[model samples]
Target: MNESAFQAGAARVDITPPLGTLINGDFITHYARFIHDPLYAKALVLQQGKTTLALVIVDICAMPKDLLDEVKIALQNETGLLPQQVLIASTHTHAAGSVASLLLGAADLPYRQKLPALLIESVKAALQHRRPAKIGFGAVDVPEHVVCRRFFMKEGYQALNPVTGGLDGVKTNPFGDEQQIDRRVAPVDPQVSFLAVKGLDDQWISVLANYSLHYVGDWENGTITADYFGVFSEEIGRLLQAGPGFVGMMSNGTSGEANIWDFLDPDRYPKAHFAKSELIGKDIAGKVANALQAIGWQEAPELSARYTEVAAGVRKPSAEELDAAKKLAAESQYETIQQVDRDALRRIYAREQVLLNDYPDTNLFPVQALQIGTGRIGALGAEFFAETGLKLKQNHQPYFTITMANGYIGYVPPAHEIERGGYETWRCRTSFLEPGAEEAIRTQLVELLKAEAERPVYSSYEIKQYER
Candidate 1:
């Protein structure tokens, strides 16, 4: 158990908006909410020998391709690291900064204009903040808090019910068969993994935590927020901090169909359960803390990295479908719908129209794999279903973490779920890819993992501070 075996650096940038404003969709006309006091972009850099890998965690809703590319290019050029070596992940915060132009409506044009500089500065700060630190990993299961949203209907009658008025005899719960309906699906990785770091004096630096549960606690109002990630970070930092300087960076795991909301069993809906998200966050953080207490430190030796983009096709709506969607969107008035049925109906029509051109029928999915000693990290570009993450971990040797929605290319539903055609699989206004996208990603990932396993071992580099 050597404390000096690894060098670590952590930096946090305040990405808070000027005045908590709504950036996603056409919400400016209706609500007036400011960003809460805290929103951040945090980074963790780990080095073993000449090979260094950097993980950037943003509190934003998601990382669109353009913005992610801009950040990646800037960080690579400045840090002298290959673009593929850096992994940028989002917290999937629905209330955070607007990055998706087509989905969220162009970020306040001014905000979009200034974002690149902010992003650059944040990454630079993280790299500059490197320090001698020790890292330890641990995991725990928090089953009661999260569940798979894709409920299979068992009764044939329920499956036959129409999801929309216009689609006659269309099955609502397409995946539900008489035998499978009502069965609860599990997370790809039900375990929460924590990587704890501390300075030479045993001072806490940051805890890099991973969990596979979707973020949907916040609403579509005009507010600058980090949703559950923000709350989770704040709670963890407060609990672990001996003083200021201590931080917590949360990386979203495979959470595609996994959500705190149990959509299948409507009885579990937390309408009055405001504390549910907080409880889930705090419970996981506590488990991470407990895990950190048990692990012994070991020097991480050797590093390898690679990045590839897999083409996942887009989903397109017909011209007539687009017109209908646009018309429905105009009527919704951005008002909150009380009835689940009405809301579901409106969302179906609205999404079909808006996503018609934006959804990817073919997607160039970015999959980056980085290795540090025996530990391996996999970067998945889309909001991956929990099942996919579980499969990767089960198949890959020495897998450390699987971060989902990294450089987000939208949701990657499981093959069977795609046929069901729900919010995640069908929301894309662009050309939707085939149902096999998840398998394709998993296959490529397995190849990367195998390659990493065969690579030769290396050692950590000596830290030498450079004069500015």
Candidate 2:
């Protein structure tokens, strides 16, 4: 590696709500009454020569596109970091305050307004605390904690989808019986990767780890929690014996189709949500702790980042699709939009966007990729299945992909899965990407990973700026 000067810093800010904050990821909303643990926004800034890059992780459901653009604009104005240079990702903790403004989740306006500033402050704080630091990278397969929630139904085992009110060929857990289940729709991503940055004194400044296990579900009844993301961070920090300035972040990987449900061993989660959360969280911490111990630290490894974007055509409703969606809405008893189930919400969102004919035959968004330390970190603004991450990791071992980064477009299932017709493919307003959209995106991302240029093609990198 080329010898050069390098500096790193990390900072955290509490974003947890005090009380009476809207909570979701469920079908309806309620006020948060208890704090399982506080939500936080953490940032890591790295500087080498004149280049600066920021990677932020927020403990929340999902950051809408507008919120991400707002934070990017604010950081650009304050820190002079280009839009591409800064990547802000959500930890995807469903129990935290809502930033996503779609069905099953709603944005807390006050929380949304304060979010950009807090995120910007984090970037600034990390910059201010920058000091000589060393970086290291390591990853291990830890598939035991996660399982694919989608299952192929055994013949004669058809089940009704709760959200869409349609019979599903494959049953998502909570709907199908184990005796009726054929096999998992797909495999889980077992790889857990960690990137450690330490100060000259040999104490950690920040440790960012990525995993494909979906959020460990448990927080409910307005108990604002950060799920396993927060738990893993705290447990790992303690195990590592991190110093004062240390900030540890555990980000959601490509877990769009994955969940903490272990089909083979259903008895493991027989308890409550928080209890089950701790069981899975500590297991992950144990695996991460062991991985951290075996890593060979690097003093000043190479660091480079690139941001590229492309517009993949949005899947518009065919006449049959439009007719089906219209039928569902017309049959619904929901007198108001608030009462519309999440499944119907998807159909309506798609219909409205198409009726106006303005969603662009294509949806354009940014994909952030950074070649740092010993591997490359790639981020997309859409929800990708574990298969997506697995494909990206091919020939790019140690490569990590963070879905729902920058902005949330919806689920981008592989073409084969799309054909399988599961809830993931149920084109809701949130997951309205066209059927072929996933292939288009994967092609673009693969090309992006191959591009060796220092400066990415910026014209295509359009940050979708708009309002609800």
Candidate 3:
């Protein structure tokens, strides 16, 4: 149609860790005892005229900047794509292998060592397989699947801060005592935004979807799975009657404060392990399949990307606090922070404080925006809140966010939410970004999206009329 110049390709490489690899995301370390399902680094390469952009979604908890920066350099050396032209993100599945150290769960050094080559392989394969393609954008709202994990407790209920040994106004992931919960502290985002790509012959290529549900973690411990993200890939392919080449990727959105656990109505989900995740994955796939039928395909939609690093402060431990932490950490009977119990949170947080004391006072986190077809996707290097994602969508229509992209900078709650004091706002390496980080990240991303929208490719009279 109308002299098309777009091309696309998709490929996936197994990145599943071997048995005995340590998995992060929880307070304690859990080793991979079995392969419940294989993990992967799925890549999609897009080209329009002389410009090319790549997106890779990996099945893991999180990857720090140092690790990903090395991967980016290798990719650039082999493919000539700049760091800003590539957008790599994690699915944030707690069941996968550790690539970044969080809490007491250390990075699996051997597993991390093997990751770069696999990631590079996926991208190179996708680049070699590029074909003439058409792309479309679609979204659906499935509010029933998302629930805000943070809540305001009733009077006299203590929401303890492990770092300070004091009371917090809000609690996260509270269960059993639902009556003590006054109301949800924040709202959840349920929008499932997707980019659907197909070859000129009408053959399926890939579907890249985004949603804000943090993760569906229902599998047993010591198992390696991609959580619901991998299941969605399978279910979507089956529903669409897609061939083996079809790639279905579900990237995590601003899900720092969202999850599938409905504490107010615990019975709403299945009680069996792995069943809830399967149900959610299939249900979400069904929604995507239904929406796919209505998309308006574009044979030659423009492709562009913008990336920048925004300055954000880190909540490093103060000298006085570090001194106290040293004293408590030394007195603890546990060998590692992972061995500390619920009653010994002071010891666990002390270790986090000592670790954070080595961090810089301010760091630069990446913010990226990509324009594919009529869809706008924003990428952030941290776990952000649902409100931030919703605000971005409201400001820029047909736009969605992909979190834990490029690098990991920890959780970024809104300043107001940080003041409320939940587990996500506690002083730890996982939640060390300053309260103002959200606002700064949001402001930068919005400007980036605006710049992409104003690019010359969409400046023509015919294109302007079609955009409306």
Which structure among the candidates has the greatest lDDT? 3
Best first by TM-score, ranked: 3, 2, 1
CA-lDDT, candidates in order = 0.63, 0.76, 0.87
Give the TM-score of each candidate. Answer: 0.80, 0.90, 0.95
Best by TM-score: 3
Candidate 2: which stretches are off by over 4 Å? 1-4, 160-167, 174-176, 319-358, 460-468
Error of 3 at 80 (Å): 1.2
Residue 307 in candidate 3, Cα distance off native in Å: 0.7
* Model 1: lDDT of residue 42: 82
| Weakest ten-residue segment in model 3 by summed lDDT | 456-465
Compared with the true structure, what per-residue lDDT tens digits does model 1 show for residues 1-468? 233356677778887766544455331221227654467878777766566677778776656666776666666667776566777887776666566543324455555566667766766776676667766666777676677765544445343211233322113233324245556544346777766777767887778778887774635356666666766677778777645776687778887767766545545544543355566677777777666677766445566776666766565666776776777777774445434364545554475556556644566677777776656778887677777877788875446454544466567777777665555665453215667778987888777777843342221110111111
Decide which is better by TM-score, 2 or 3: 3
Clashes of 2: 3
Deviation (Å) of 433 in candidate 1: 2.3
